[model samples]
Target: MTAVRVAVIGCGSIAKHRHLIEYDLQPGVEITAVCDIVEERAKAAAEKYGATAYTDYETLLKEEEVDAVSVCLPNYLHAPVSIAALEAGCHVLCEKPMATSREEAQQMIDAANKNEKKLMIAHNQRFVPSHQKARELIEQGEIGKIYSFRTAFGHGGPEGWSVDGKDSWFFQKEKAFIGAMGDLGVHKADLMRYLLGEEFTEVAGFVESSAKEGSDVDDNAVCILKSASGVVGTLAASWAYSAKEDNSTVIYGEKATLRLEDDPNFSLVAQYVSGEVVKYELGGIQTNDAGGQTTSKVIHHFITSITENTTPPIDGEDGKKSLEVILNALESAETKRICG
Candidate 1:
């Protein structure tokens, strides 16, 4: 089979670190093109990867013969760019917080359906080894009757991660739409649903902008989530974790408790009612810190789904459902009432 030609729509930190690097590692994949509004960034990536570069995505889509494209643009551009790529006869792998609203996300999905193409969301937490192990243990009844849980994704803000630093679109309300809730909260929301195999029924939370000095978007948020199976838990997203990044989850159950990514050495640990403890040294998760670029397995998965003509693990509807949780959380925060 011929290698699947791919293009990256943004040359930001995510593109440089995850999408581009991972795509290069796949066996039957070729980097055909890259696009970015900033010409220099696109050119740099193109030169390094030996692909063409364009400042405008529409031009790149029209000119390149790519089988798939990674929509690594900002939160606001995900839907539109993905729809365009799908319409241009290319499968799309969009980044998280897939769109600004349900309508936009649905539009992207519709375009993919109409074009007979795949649409995958970049919710990499679901692919983490420890997270997958936790799900398997739960499925095997290792943690019986899950009652409650707490999951968090926090860092010291995106200034250190984004290419533009403080001036990146991440801190702007208009471009980012929502801040910590969209950036970090959505990942945990999707991960919790994947691990527990349940949908969120209701949410109530506090969203705040008290972290960064001159940012209009929220930097810290706390949400109370209730799952369909009567499992209640807390989900937190914050750019205020100044000391260290915390991407951890603890699930409480009737027979045992599961802790994931909560330790420096052990990536996962399960403690049982019988005074037995099992620890898993499954390596570390992907992080923004230097030398922390563990493979997310998202880009490779997207390529495989396209080559195999199968539905991606996190499809467009899955992205929409995860997005809905954050949307309802925002509503709950604003109205001071629970939202479903």
Candidate 2:
């Protein structure tokens, strides 16, 4: 097997927990470089993953041997870094909420197309066994016709999770752009789109900073979506929940309803119209410590697409669709009106 040389562009929590660690586990992939503005963080990741370290991403991109790069930077830098890597002849696996705006996301897609490289987004929830099962059932007509759904992802706060606590770029409007919506809501929106196999046509939302004092970004948000197929649903995300919930999605169909919760266990429960409830315990979707399970799967798909000259399951266009949904949600909140 020819190993693909991979470089990580950020040493943040997601990079450390998902990108680097998962790539380390893959037999046909090698973590060749780690980059971060903080030299110490990059060096630590390099030492941990047995890879080279660079404080600037440009240095890593210049390495001729690197076949791929993971853009794990803050929300704002996702598009710029991914475009640079793709233009440099490297496949890119970008983290979720692909970019702060639709235009930026489209630019990344355009660059990928121009370079003829695989570009994938890390919407890991789509790879979870339970979520896949839900998608399968929906596709197979087990749910009849999807009418509506609800999903959420919430956590205590960014204080402990982020390297810089309240001082983290996540709390800053300029660096992070939107708050919980970008941080967590985007996952639910993507999950809903994946399960229903539809694009959100409109969105209405409300955002607030209820928990933290002096926070510029939102700590909680709720958005309602209307899909192209006329399915109506609600998506909620927050960093203010007392207990952490990773990712949860519920789909209501004409014949039944399906529920998926990431923590506690990966279980799929369906309540039928006949009053017979079915439960499926899916232990196969388990992730190693650091939430790298889906990350690893996404990386594998990206590499396979490049190696085989095929399209990835969640390609650049897919990333743009998810980003559009979230961005529209933000616009809805700001104007107190539905947006597309």
Candidate 3:
């Protein structure tokens, strides 16, 4: 397809800061349309990207003849918008926490399949350099027999980065589903699966909304995950990290333990039982910092997938697997019992 014609739905912070910007910069992609409920935001983005703007997504989906779309809307709207786009014959790149529940996620995959369209989820952690290096090391047997692990993603709060600040839809339970778990926890879920190359079989968790004030949704969440291979680990997601952000992952194995983003200088390190050590200088994980190194090669992959007529790296099935982990964690927290 010529330039992989694309449209971006939602002119929010992520749309403005990363998605659109990256699309504009990507070599084989073109920003064809921009849509948002807020007309002003849509107009602003349209002006910036030289793309037509629409206030309603329905009109945009019906009118615009784009090859693909980036569904950057809120959590609740993900499945619906993506389904519509897929049915409209457009490949979709939807943001993370694929949907509010497993059923919704399944419907999305079915829609994509029925329409013969591609669906990619924006799970950016898998594209991180350090995380990629660690995965390679583990796969190469640098970390012999993995036993357990701990991964966490936390920051001050979405209030600082969200388009609506403290009043963002993220604080609204109906709109966000489960705040930190959806926003941050799901990333770790996907990452752990990618790094360990296994699916989580069971999960137990504690989710809380005690961090930020005036928010009804959870700000803190921690889950214990057991993989199909009996590899257990702790995954944490939080908005109460006021001092600094902590997005770290560590894997313990018999031969050597691989640490990712654990030190000040070395972003990835492996320590062996034979007193051997390997330090890597790959960049650390991107946090909520606006000026930080945030964007990834995800856009390039998306465009390439569309042009080459291949399934994206982070496809709908992959997204659903990660979403299941987070959704199960929420259920485990509510029932105070282990969930599968």
Q: Which candidate has the top score in TM-score?
A: 1
lDDT of 2 by residue, 235-334 (tens): 9899888664456778899999998863355378888999998888875443433543444477667778877889888888988888888888888888
lDDT of 3: 0.91
Best by the lDDT measure: 1
- The global Cα lDDT (0 to 1) of model 2 is 0.84
Considering summed lDDT, which 10 consecutive residues are worst modelled in model 3? 283-292
List per-prediction Cα lDDT, in the order shown: 0.94, 0.84, 0.91
Give residue 137's lDDT in candidate 1 (0 to 100).
93
Structural similarity to truth (TM-score) of each candidate = 0.99, 0.94, 0.98
In candidate 1, position 240 carries an lDDT of 98
lDDT score for candidate 1 against the true structure: 0.94
Choose 2 or 3, whichever is better by lDDT: 3
lDDT per residue (tens digit) for residues 1-340 in model 1: 9999999999999999999999988999999999999999999999999999999999999988999999999999999999999999999999999999999999999999999999999999999889999999999998889999999999999999999999989999888999999999999999999999999999998999998988998899999999998999999999999999999999999999999999889999999999999999998998989988559999878988988999999999999999999999999989999999
Better TM-score candidate (2, 3):
3
Winner of 1 and 3 under lDDT: 1
Model 3 TM-score, all chains together: 0.98
Per-residue lDDT tens digits for candidate 3, residues 33-112, read 99999999999999999999998889998998999999999999999999999999999999988999889999999999
